[model samples]
Target: MTNNTLLLFSRLYHHDSRVFKEFLNQLPNDEQTMPINSTIKFEQQTSANHSVPDGAITQESFKIVIETKLYGQEDIDQIIKHTDSFDGEKNKYLMLINVHQIHEDYKVKIRNKLNEKGTDVQLIDTAFEDIITSFRSVINEYDTEMSMIIDDYEDYCNGANLISIEDRLMRALPVGDTLDHNFKYKLYYAPASRSYNRRHRYLGLYTRKEIKGVGKIELIVDADYYKESKKFKWEVVEGNKDQLTDEVIDNIVQSMFHGEEEFGYQIYKGHRFFIVPEFIETKFEKVSPGGLLGAKYFDLTDYGLVKEELDTQLIAEKLKEETWK
Candidate 1:
């Protein structure tokens, strides 16, 4: 898996070194580690002088030794051994790419060991998600062929489950007469039995075969509506309920009333309510038939929306003008 990922990077670099450099610039690195006017070389499990094992991106002035970890597993001795590969480079780096952040204690130990060896290599820690983000950031600059290659690489990563589905996916729900209420209160409610392939961090409002709005899911509550008492008993199922204030609760009740008036409280006897701080208006059209029969998930990153610093309003605006690929 690690070699496959490194090969993708090498392919991208060979296609256009500038794009590869831009991708690297987006990663967490020092100024000294940045590549300049030097011939770039991509090596896989090969040594500059029979040292260095994993992947590496080398330049005349600097070298970046990459060690990829699929899980959080780290071997201190193995990592220390790679330090010997950095021989008198002006700027040397040991880039640890993992699915999760490396522990601070491990980083401390690595740094201390490097100091002991008097090696000048800088240790940089990043994740697979970061790599995807950086690559996506520069993807728009390339033409169709290059863009397709980038997409293929991303698809490969997705197939390998290197990028988390839950983190990048947005669940789209169909709306009818309650569309206005959903937009007004930024809430959506449905029967608790509605099946979902996976948990999602975002929600999209679908109406007229088009996604009209999008929002970051702030809370999901399991609610039981009582028609006799004209009230609801709810428990937090996904998010922090403590963040739900009196004003928010009132809005939720209002949304429930609107639903009950149209579909009846019985329809919501045991339901799930999804709440968002605000809904950003959008018009993401569904080109295919069978208009959103059930919950549909779309990978937001597939559309080049950076999940880390995602702007709902910006996404909404982009959706209005751009066609879904």
Candidate 2:
């Protein structure tokens, strides 16, 4: 629904045809013969559904109509209308950019429409995840300004939950050996269904993993479990003690520990998971693990969390010292 995203994509496609072609290659049935250095022209609002396709790319005998989407699911008829504006020549394509998987039925309908019109408008469905990754693949080989743009756009997509996977692994271990065990880690999946207005905002300790069928799954500790146990009760944050009604605490604890029924104690295929923190009010303290997962049962110092961002030399000196926020 936003033109800013379309403008950004148009800029990237025109700026580097190679990256654009690389993105096109993600389509299973696409056969892009446009030269790597072809003189490509990218424009927006130029189709029958003048508003349907966000942009279009043209080079020699190729014309690619690109439609970018984040959460919108346009009807197949909206896309079919684009062929009406086509000149019935060149290698035409209709590309849909979305995060969710496009159903096979829609693809069939699109192909049938194009066939009836006698146009070679092939359908290319590209997930936002793949689009962001394509930009990342060629990000390092670009000029400073272009590189900054791609970097900024990638960050924007990630923040919007359009692309679920994290660029880097959130690990506590250093490159070499592993002798330290100051923090315990939990692997959990944060499905896309929970992306919009997630109830829990204090997902302090977690990592994102890309599952085959599931978009992005987060791996984090069982906060409610760690908090309810006798081992962790002592370290509960004092600020929210009055609000922690017995009913509320019981609900949270039960919800966290109860495994997913559909998947049977796993997210999907042995992927252990936990619920995000909710109704827990505590200061956003970096060193205090008392809010949800308390210091009594687990220490922030376990994974070198406190020392990593502070000071290395100071961390070395306080290797055995307790951490306080």
Candidate 3:
């Protein structure tokens, strides 16, 4: 399944090398094994006079052997064996593409094994998500046929479960009296037991049948609030909590206290908080009746509100002005 996807990309590269070069530039190539001014050709299941069959992207002076795994945890022996395919090439590389990020320890093990054999092939580890993001970044919006190809490739990845649909989603939650408060602190809290999909990267603040604000979620922490002591203790359940500082904690505590006082109840006890570095104003009105209940997920890609290279503020601006298609 994964090889077929590579073949598609290889064929696309053959059609237009310029766009493919941009896509390749997005990948992590520290040693710069990819040739700049050489003729490039892509082959699949090619031996190149070797025993082990692997994909090859060859140039005049360099060769990149691609070993793809639908799942992570590749065989070290097989990978090392692939190094034999490079024969007197000025630049040689062994690219490992997987569905998950290859662990650093695993890469170290591969490097150590290669060293034991005195092999000089450079190793490149990347995930399918990175490839998709890179391809999307370089796609020309005016080229309708190229856009269709990308859509088809993305659909295939999504169908194979190689990519998470939620990553392109923006989940909107209804805000009540705490709308201003949420915007003020760039935080939102709810009961820990509340059932909602939490995989989304962007959160939309919905009120009055319209989304008024949005922010990229930076951290999500589960906390236990003690009203008697006026203290809160939290442990990160998702995102980088290392950025969480004492000042941020104080702000969250103050927000919790204000919620308790306004709602006449302990809203902070056993709650999960979603914190963002900053929230930007937006206006995405909903056409459906009965307002938003619970949470609603919008496909930011489908709406053209997001691109891999776009920042949060740009996305907010697009959301504010663009109408849902």
Candidate 3 yields a Cα-based lDDT of 0.76
Please, what is the TM-score per model? 0.50, 0.46, 0.55
Give the alpha carbon lDDT tens digit for every residue of 1-325 in model 3: 5466567567568667887877776776546536645477777787744455458878777778888776565678877888888878777778887766576667889989989989788887877778878877887778787677777877877787777655667888888777898988788888889867436788889888788888888888887768788767888766666767887787678888787777764767688888988888889877656788778888787766545755678778878766542
Candidate with the larger TM-score of 1 and 2 = 1
Ranking by TM-score: 3, 1, 2
Q: After superposition, how far is residue 138 of candidate 1 from its true place, in Å?
A: 27
User: In model 3, what lDDT does residue 287 have?
Assistant: 66
TM-score for candidate 1: 0.50
Misplaced by over 4 Å in model 2 are: 1-19, 27-29, 32-37, 47-52, 72-74, 141-143, 165-325
> For residues 187-231, what per-residue lDDT tens digits would candidate 2 score against the true structure?
233332443222121223311111001011222322323433433
Clashes of each: 0, 6, 0
Which pairs of residues collide in model 2?
182-302, 183-302, 183-303, 188-218, 188-219, 190-218
- Candidate 3 is scored at a TM of 0.55
Which has the higher TM-score value, candidate number 2 or candidate number 3? Answer: 3
- Computed on alpha carbons, the lDDT of every model, listed in order, comes to 0.75, 0.46, 0.76
The local lDDT score (0 to 100) that residue 57 gets in candidate 2 is: 68
Q: In model 1, which residue pairs have backbone atoms overlapping below 3 Å?
A: none
Q: Which ten residues in a row have the lowest lDDT in candidate 2?
A: 173-182
Any runs in candidate 1 off by more than 4 Å, and if so which?
A: 1-163, 265-268
